[model samples]
Target: MSSIEGRHPDRNLINMPMKQNLVKEKHDASLHLISRDFETCIDVCQKALHVLSSTVDLQQASDHQEEMEEFIVIIVQAYAELDRWQEVLPCITQHYSGIENVSPNVLKVCLLLHAKVQEFSTCSALYNIWTSSREGREVNDSDLEMLLDIYVTQTLLQAGKSSQITEVVQSSQLSQDTKERLIATYSELVRETQLAEETASTTALPDLAHPQNIVDRVVAKGLRALRMMLMWIWSVRPRLSTRTLYSLGGLATLLIIATQGFDTSNRTLEILGNLMEHFIRSKR
Candidate 1:
């Protein structure tokens, strides 16, 4: 082809940008986000989105996937800062599909923004994906805290759902570490509740934990949590044969100590005694 757009047309067309011009063009909007100039960044990001949509077809989304995801991240973050929460999910969802792998930062942006607005449905979907997918599963501990805050605080999980928690522990794609943490948190909450009930007349329990802060002595979650703790302990007990119980003897011993660490009421003392007896029997 004559008069072609050949490689040597402009002296072997240099890809190396000479000035800071190219760097500025690529990162100026990102710098806006760093400075918390979200409004300016939002404009730049939206323009980038428009250009991407106009230039690429659905079939070519993979071609621009990395750059497009970066644009989506900036857009969502800007929206989050603006408190335009309702718009953030759709913005991420449109570009995010099954095959596309998003960065952890993008998952975080989606999860937190959705949680902030109490968008439980969307948050659940995002969380299920985050928990299940290997692509974005290695979450930071702080990010895990943020996720639990949304689950325990915002999402309305009925406290006594042993079946539900069991299902999650067994079937979930969450790592063993996450499952163990969840159970540990639940147990610690139970321990705290017992301690709080023992001293509640002098001190106040927090509202989110239960209604002991106010006139009511108990609420739905509190009762459910209390009952569920007992049920879980019992449910685990039946599986203990001589060998099994002996295997768990150390933990049983620990449990007796842990149970005693709370209130020392007659009922609690009875439990502690029973646990002590059980641990002794298991030793033989």
Candidate 2:
């Protein structure tokens, strides 16, 4: 009896290490399967999907469903890296019914890629799935806030809808800290766009300014001056309130029109000069 009892404990101890080894092996295999080549990755993902859909075995179906979602993320990343957006879009659309099961990390990567490629239409579609998905519900509020910020910013920038951008940035749900960061990003983008427009206009103006053409020279010079003034306004506009900026802009427009007709009357010139002085002071 004593010998039998001693052997029983020894046997249990021996089996514990084997069980641990098997668990480790299973984990290693899953990782290996995920890291395999593209063809192999697709094969694995498809096999997982097949098992999930056809299997009547509850345990097997549940396990395979989890594995399939993980592998789908891997395959999607692979497609994105190759810039095979066409393939990625279809695959996402077809399997998107299961997106609630997809990991947030994978969702973030997909959203970012869509944003980068200027796929606003796709991004908008995916955002609906994302907002309604179980995984999206599982996301922390702070994370959701950040994701919304990124989406709105990219969408507005791509669409050139500055008004919408301002509306989104003003949301009370957005944290103050994030609001400040987004404001800075918006300001930077505005500056860059203004600079690009100025550069293009400058490059095109030289063709219109010729030595032998008096009319063309005058027109080009006037256009150049107008562009310079616009640049000045764009640079300073963000620093002031919208109301103040609009008032100043209107004043400048009226002065330009009044002076354009060669009105040298004392009252007209004095009014134009006073408006110009106000515009200059506002810049300071």
Candidate 3:
């Protein structure tokens, strides 16, 4: 069945309210659709989009500029869920340019969705707009930093390009905290890659009769070592200012510890060890 039949018919009808009631009703209707039938969700979303598009219509006698800006956000969110990222990008770009009184919440949502679809070029363009705008000065939200970091990291890893990654790390605009997190993530990836290479070079089979050859022993040792190091670092993280250097040292230490002991606990250890073994085999 179509999702629209489940939604309230009246909610789809838009009327101009001089006060904030128009935006509130629209928000409420959108939320209602979310809680009910998924199909009905689309109808409410399209209605919100219609409200936004019509406000700018030349035929309209009065332009409700602020209300239109508010409704655009609702539409953007709906398009995101449908994975119509292409549609969202233009709407966001237009809003970013045309709206003088746009909120940070709106800009944040646009940036986040743009990042999710791997529209790095568009994100760069929007970033330029945001940085130059007077409103841009207040864009201190962490979500934006996280989205950009993830996009840049994934793009670099997939393309096997380190120069751009290094550039981003050295860039003065990125906060020290975000830079440190990215460095740690990158370091972990490098360690995993090296471990994979080492495993590929070794072909000697471990004796099953030997306790160390048992799956549980290896995983237990790895997890215990990892947990201890993670706890120690997390505890010290607040006090440390040299995040990138500290994270590199911590990961190196953890890698060393992971290679040391192999004491088994239960089936969980066996499962993890078997998983690692499978990973090793697949790499070959």
Best by TM-score: 2
Backbone clash count, each prediction separately: 0, 0, 4
Q: What lDDT does the true structure give each of the candidates? A: 0.55, 0.57, 0.54
Q: Is candidate 1 or candidate 3 better by lDDT?
A: 1
The parts of candidate 2 lying over 4 Å away from their true place are: 1-40, 49-70, 81-84, 93-102, 132-138, 170-173, 204-284
Q: What ordering of candidates by TM-score runs from best to worst?
A: 2, 1, 3
lDDT of 1 by residue, 160-248 (tens): 32234445444544568877877777666656665776898545646546433331222223333444553455467754455544444
Please give, for residues 13-97, the per-residue lDDT of candidate 2 as tens digits.
2134533543454444356555654555555555544444443333232334454456566666556656676676556445544
Error of 2 at 68 (Å): 5.8
Model 3, residue 271: C-alpha shift (Å):
29
User: What is the lDDT ranking, best to worst?
Assistant: 2, 1, 3
Any idea how many clashes model 1 has? Answer: 0
Off by more than 4 A, model 1: 1-26, 34-37, 50-70, 97-101, 129-166, 174-178, 189-284
Q: Indicate the TM-score of model 3.
A: 0.41
- List per-candidate RMSD values in Å: 21.2, 18.5, 21.5
